[model samples]
Target: MSSVTIEARHEAWPLREAFVISRGAKTAADVVVVEAIDGAHRGRGEAVPYARYGETVEGVIETIRSAAVHISSHADLTRFLKPGAALNALDCAFWDLESKRTGIAVSARAGLPHPIAKITAFTLSLDTPSVMAEKAARVPHLSLLKLKLGGTGDDLRMQAVRQARPDAHLLVDANEAWTTETIGAFLTAAVECDIELIEQPLPAGHDDILADIPHPVPLCADESVHTADNIETLLGRYDAVNVKLDKAGGLTGAMRLVAEARRHGLKIMIGSMVATSLAAAPAMLLAPYADWIDLDGPLLLARDREHGLHIENGIIQPPDPQLWG
Candidate 1:
């Protein structure tokens, strides 16, 4: 009488173009995939191992494999794995497995409304002012744009992109590349560029400077806050929190952070690391609660798997069950 079986593997998908951030560049998204099988039902989950979080694909798969034998239920998953890429994949797998076995959608199980199509922020990789402007111009149809910013000459980059796409909603992500000397000027540039939000202008654990800075544009915490427990400490520093399943363990843990953030009056940004639609699908369940949606991962890929989430222009339709919940 076999109960549930677990399996995990790594996959690499080529990017349409190099994804450049303050951290560096990547031409491919290497992801870890988790599977849970029970009788004739099968569930899947995908997560990108982020190097910034010190997670590698090999390490993530190993962790999942070692803990697989002990995981049979949601509570068992939590007890066996700590929060990270490994746990996130397993948690999401459990969600899909439950939905498959019980015939209940994830949103219904969690008492949330079914996901509807929504517009998402299309990201422009970090580049020179002129290059960034050209990239922004290429996507003239996209109404929302998220710019990957590097500190030294970011003001000109913002001005350039904004000039090219005056009709677009602008969001800036420094990826913690801005220094104290540059942050002041950068904040002013965001105002001049009509930027709506800024993410992680300074490094985590070194973001105290944000307390004294006057935010003409709202700041959102990406690297600073991980779990629900980190919300209260970020009160004055950030106006919002960016929730990524990779950072929060999975949908289960992300909901905890979302609830905590709302309680403290912090707005939410539902975001993701560049991966396939499989990874993006589960995050969409939380989209209704977000002030901004940055789940354009599939659009950045050279090609995605069949039956993936359908995103056209800048609007994304909810995931098809053939893909996942």
Candidate 2:
């Protein structure tokens, strides 16, 4: 095997303006890009901070730099970084580099026979009821929509959007806003509005309540589950788990999570933190095995790096190598 080295670069995107949520985001998003080089071939990956995980662009860069020595030695990608943004970027870059060296697409290497467009959930950031409703109305043709909720005002926000886009398949991600006492009532309201799934209603440590409460909509674990290590704990509390490349540390852990979640009879949703197309492409390798896909990272960007994944009408096409493997 040829020795490869990984390098990290930091980039930023000034949001067209501040994007608000239960947590706050101001202008300019900080991002880290990892590039792996061996001989003349190169593969790249990008990772973005998840405020939920308390990650920043600088922190992600530091983590990647620490991993660089191991990546140069070509140590096992699967064992290096704990599940988080840094490992996710390196794991993806390694996979990309390997595919390029061998001239094989990730799907083919993973035993998938063909690549096709995947239906994706377009996310609506947390906002006021009327504004969210107006935004939902514009996406009339989307087959799936993921709504962000978690504030004091979410009830009206959800109701308004659901009222406007009644036909769109809807799911809600509270990002750990609702408490145990509120979960049942929230699910009740969600079901009344025909919402299909509710993700991460409670914060990670406080999820025991899920086992006792009856959930009308399928409940999915997001903040609560990372890597395969957390899968056993997540059972019975959640019907599904949202697997993000950043959260699992990369495709390696993601595949492990998929296999184990199937063994435990948990539905899988492949997702991404808002990054760029370079970040989303690696995760696409596992989408064929997931029940729902949320690779809209590029969609959230004011602009994306060139030649990334192409998304149209809320469907994500397979990766084009001009972007990343």
Candidate 3:
């Protein structure tokens, strides 16, 4: 048997601009990365420890370290860790390391098709309606734009963005920021502005109210649906789910989510936190299964690592092996 080593560390990548969402604004994406060495081959994976989920970079790093002794293979991963960013980074690193060691592409090893370049949604950070419109107007080449919402003026915000970029498709993520009183108006605005999808309009536990509301525009479960264990509860309330690798414990749990989402007849949207291309690279492989692709993290960053995934005008090229699997 060859020697193997794995370690985790924290990294912070600056964003081109502050990414303001319903929860808050972040100028830098603080992430935890797991790097594994198998003999002469090396592989890496990244995950952003989101505060909304009560995760911190330090906590995630410790989690990865505690679980390092058990990093034997990818089977029965839940036995070692829970669903969140830490397990995500570890599992992703395992896949990358495996692909490198075995001389096989991750897509092939996973029984998926060859990964390809695909279009992704450019994000418009939450701001005043006019400011958001200005942001939308600036990205005329990106045909799909996902807006950060959940404020009181979402309807106006939607209208302004639409007026500014009528040609672009739109997805709205409220990040569990909306309330029962505000959902009605927001849904109406989404319909009026041709919003393609509305994500987590209400808080996770509070989203049961969604069952009573009419969804002229389809609603997607973000915070409400993490692992497939929560999919049953969201069936009557949600039309789709946004699967982020970090939330689903990397590609392992993420594939399970795709299977469960399909079995439950729910649409899929592959999403990511604002981080470097390393975080988005592995997640991009799921683009084939998603109804929408929102892995725009690299595009939001001020700079990415060498041999990062090439993204031009919101079009994402498959990640090079030098970067990850």
Candidate 4:
């Protein structure tokens, strides 16, 4: 077996503007990048340490450094670390390294078809109804728009956005800001606004109310579902799931979740944290299996990595091997 070396670093990329959600706002994306080196081959991966999940940049880097001593192979790395941003970075680095060493695309190694360019959902940050509408009007060419909504005046926000871009398909993400009682009202407004999906209207553990309600607009679980282990419990409550590598650990776990979610007839949505194209590339591989794609993280940044995934009129081009697998 060839010897391996691991290095990790934290990078902060400024966002074009503040990305506001129900929880709060962020001006920059602080991410941990992991690089695995084996002889002449090198692999790289990036992950954002999410504060909502009790993750910090320093903590993630430490976790990667500690795990590097024991992880000699990609297979070992899978079971070596728990599902989170730390493992995600290392896992993706392994995939990238293997791809470079063997000259095989990561998709081919995973038994997935070659990915093609696809339309991705452009996100509109949370703001007042009129501000949201103005933002929506500016991106008229984008076929899909994912709106960030707070519990209050969410209906008005949806209405204004709908009025601004009548032709675009809309997805609403409340980010667990709404209560069980308010979700029904939101769904009612979603229907009126012709919204196709409403994501994580209620908090994760408080989603029991979903089982008893009638869903006019399909509800997608962002926080309520993580890896495949959480899928069975969400069968009746959620119509779809938002899979992010940061949340699923890496492509390995995300693929498992995708397969399991599909087996249970749940719709799939490939989502991302506000990170760079390196972080978005791995998630794009799963876009083929997803009903909704939201890999617009790099587009939200002021500048992205060299040779990053290309986005033209809201469509994402496949990643170059140099950028990632």
Candidate 5:
């Protein structure tokens, strides 16, 4: 194996507008891009550092830089770094580089079938009920819509969106904002509005509440579940798990998590943080295992990288080779 050279940089992609969720709002997506090169072939990957997990762009970049010196192979990377944004970028880049060097598609390398286009759930950022409804109305062509919900007035927000897009499938993500005391009313409204799924309705530690109550709508775990290690604990509480490449560390860890989640009879929802297509491409490979797909991160940006994933009428086509793997 040839010695690999690594390059890492930070990028701030401007969002078309501020994207708000239960936590807060941001006008730009701060991402770390990593490239691994061996001989002439190059593979690239991107990751968004999440502050909720105590990650900063500077911290993530430094972490990658520190590990890059010893990472001559993809397998070495897995042992060198823990699961997080930093390792996600490096791990994905290694996969991409390997695919390019071997002249093989990532799907084939991962022992998966060729990726087919699928309908992705476009997200409506958290806002007033009227505003969210208006936003949902603007994207009537989309069949599935993911709504970001905060604690208060969640009922009104769901009702408003359902009224606007009566035919659309609905998924709600609370992003660890709700408390045990208030989740009942929220779940009540969610079911009343015919929500397809509710994601992370309450914070991680408080997920025990889910086991106590009858889930009117199937609940999916996002912030509460990261990798396969989290699957066993979430079995009774969550009906599904949202696997994002960033959270699982990369495609390798994500595939493991998906298999583990399935073994426990839990549904899978492949999700993404607010990043570019480079980040979404690897996550897209996991869509076949997911019941709900939310790789609409690039669609939310003001501009995406060249050769980005093509999303027409909410159906995301497979990533072009130039985009990543």
Candidate 6:
């Protein structure tokens, strides 16, 4: 094992300038990258601004800096970190570093045969019905599209995208924007559109309404399902769960979530924040068991760190660890 030193850095990217979302994100993209260096090997990981988690680039940098002293002293990746953006980045960097050191793949480290690249959902950020339809039509070889839903009239948006791309699989992410009354109408439209899944329509604490609602699309728990401890309460409410390494805190929590979610028959979706490729690489281990994939973090970025994961069309390839440990 090589002695590793870790450092964290932040970068800002300007959006297309006109791009905006219901979440009020309009011009800038900021992310924090964690780098772990050992001898000639360097591994990297990045995390985005998780609005739900109150994470800014500076906050994540501060969080990682607080742990740098502890992480640099520990050689074991698994025991070195906790979960969240800071730990997620560092944990992934450690995995990348170890993979390079051992001359084996990340799948081999986790006892899997090989990393199988799978079709992922291309996201259509919140936009006008016509604009979203146009965006959806442009994505090539895309079987799945995750539509960001949180506007006044999602039925029109959903119908427009569906009409535009009748052959593509569709899913909706409301980002905790639905009310009890609007959910029925929203779901009705999704059912008519033949949507496959709906994620976190209602806010977490008020999601009890889902228990009685008859949803045509399978419901996926995103904000509702964080760590392994959440699976029990989430059993009857959601048909699937979105597992992001950031929310799970690190690989240790994510592995536990996969087992616990399966024990309850909840379908798994390995998701990620709008991070660089480095952040999504480590979570690729969960790909084998996931029913859905949303590792499109780097795809959303203007440019990724060097030697990032390869993405072609909608399929995400395995990571090249030369960029991060």
Q: Candidates sorted by lDDT, descending order? A: 4, 5, 1, 3, 2, 6
The C-alpha stretches of model 3 lying farther than 4 A from their native spots are none
| Candidate 1 regions with alpha-carbon error over 4 angstroms | none
| Model 1 weakest 10-residue run by lDDT | 69-78
- Tell me how many clashing residue pairs each candidate has: 1, 1, 0, 0, 0, 8
Q: Model 3 clash pairs?
A: none
Residue-by-residue lDDT tens digits, candidate 4, 1-325: 4988999999999999999999999999899999999999999999999899899999999999988999899988866799999989999999999999999999999988789888999999999999999999998789899999989899999999999999999999999999876877888899999999999999999889899999999999999888999998998899999998998989999999999999999999999899999999999998889899999999899999998999999999889999998
By summed lDDT, the worst window of 10 consecutive residues in model 6 runs over 13-22
TM-score of each: 0.98, 0.94, 0.97, 0.99, 0.99, 0.91
- Per-residue error at 12 for model 1, in Å? 0.4
Off by over 4 Å in 6: 1-3, 14-21, 26-28, 72-82
By lDDT, the best candidate is: 4
Clashing pairs in 1: 88-249
With a 3 Å backbone cut-off (N, CA, C), the pairs that clash in candidate 2 are 88-249
Report the C-alpha lDDT of model 5 over 166-191, residue by residue, as the tens digit: 99999999988888888988988988
Q: Per-residue error at 310 for model 5, in Å?
A: 0.5
Q: What is the lDDT of residue 81 in candidate 6?
A: 51
Which residue segments of model 2 deviate by more than 4 Å?
A: none
> All models: lDDT?
0.91, 0.81, 0.88, 0.93, 0.92, 0.79
Better model by TM-score, 3 or 6?
Answer: 3
Q: Which model, 2 or 4, shows the larger lDDT?
A: 4
